[model samples]
Target: MSTLRIYISNQCPSCATAIHRVHFVRRLRPEQSVELINLDHQDTVRPSYVFGTPTYCLGNQIIFLGNPSEGELLSKLDQPLSSVKQIT
Candidate 1:
């Protein structure tokens, strides 16, 4: 298992898209843990490099910079996951 942290901002469409990707991954792998951090409420240590909302970080490394298809997202996540099942 890995730490899947998603930074989101309220009232942002891109944020919603990112959320969808997280849920999609979670659906396929229920054992994985996911955390949704609100940028509005949390002081992310580093926000400069990330392009925009919907940024995804697997553990302490960024796996995705923008909203990507569930497939692409899964591949990055798979790199750190101990177990994962593919879902269409």
Candidate 2:
């Protein structure tokens, strides 16, 4: 199964909105998995190439840089594994 990785910071309103949207999606799709990474509390170093807070990563590919529309997220979730290549 694919995971949705959400990168966030405490002070970002957009992050809160993104999280809310993710939870909304989760309620609709219980099987979907989500991982929230709080930049403020990270113990390890963050990748330098990461775009910004409220980023959404599907597998190794980033689907959104900031807040994503519900439809956009759902569409990505609906994509089959055959269509999305797994990145190393």
Candidate 3:
């Protein structure tokens, strides 16, 4: 029941790839809850820890700072949140 939050910005070239990766995860894990946060939007509030675009966070912890391989993303999603380490 954990949610995955993807923080993206319109200016980032790799954000699209990260968005696609989220879709890929959704297709494979339909039960997982994923939220996409676009920093470019004025209503969206950027998290203090997120210094760059295409950041993926599971709960409050950042899992990846940029676009990650589909396999790596899936692997992290499959593991317990406590065991998953932050990836840059």
Top candidate, metric TM-score: 3
Better of 2 and 3 by lDDT: 3
lDDT winner: 3
lDDT of 3 by residue, 1-88 (tens): 6799999999999998988987898899999999999999999998788999899999888989888899999988989987866544
The lowest-lDDT stretch of 10 consecutive residues in candidate 1 is 79-88
For model 3 the TM-score comes to: 0.92
Per-residue error (Å), model 3, residue 12: 0.3
What is the alpha-carbon lDDT for the whole of candidate 2? 0.78
Measured against the true structure, the TM-scores of the candidates, in listed sequence, are 0.73, 0.82, 0.92
Number of clashes found in candidate 3? 0
Candidate 1: tens digits of C-alpha lDDT, residues 1-88: 6688888878667888877777887799788789887777756564565556777877656667677788887777667443333222
Q: Write the per-residue lDDT of candidate 2 for residues 1-88, one digit (tens) a residue.
A: 7788888888988888887977887898889888888888959456565657887878766777898789888888888755764444
- Count of clashing pairs, candidate 2: 0
Could you arrange the candidates by TM-score from highest to lowest?
A: 3, 2, 1
- After aligning candidate 1 to the native by TM-score, how far in Å is the CA of 41 from where it should be? 2.3
Output the lDDT of residue 37, model 2.
Answer: 84
Off by over 4 Å in 1: 42-51, 80-88
Poorest 10 consecutive residues by lDDT, candidate 3: 79-88
Q: Count the clashes in each prediction.
A: 0, 0, 0
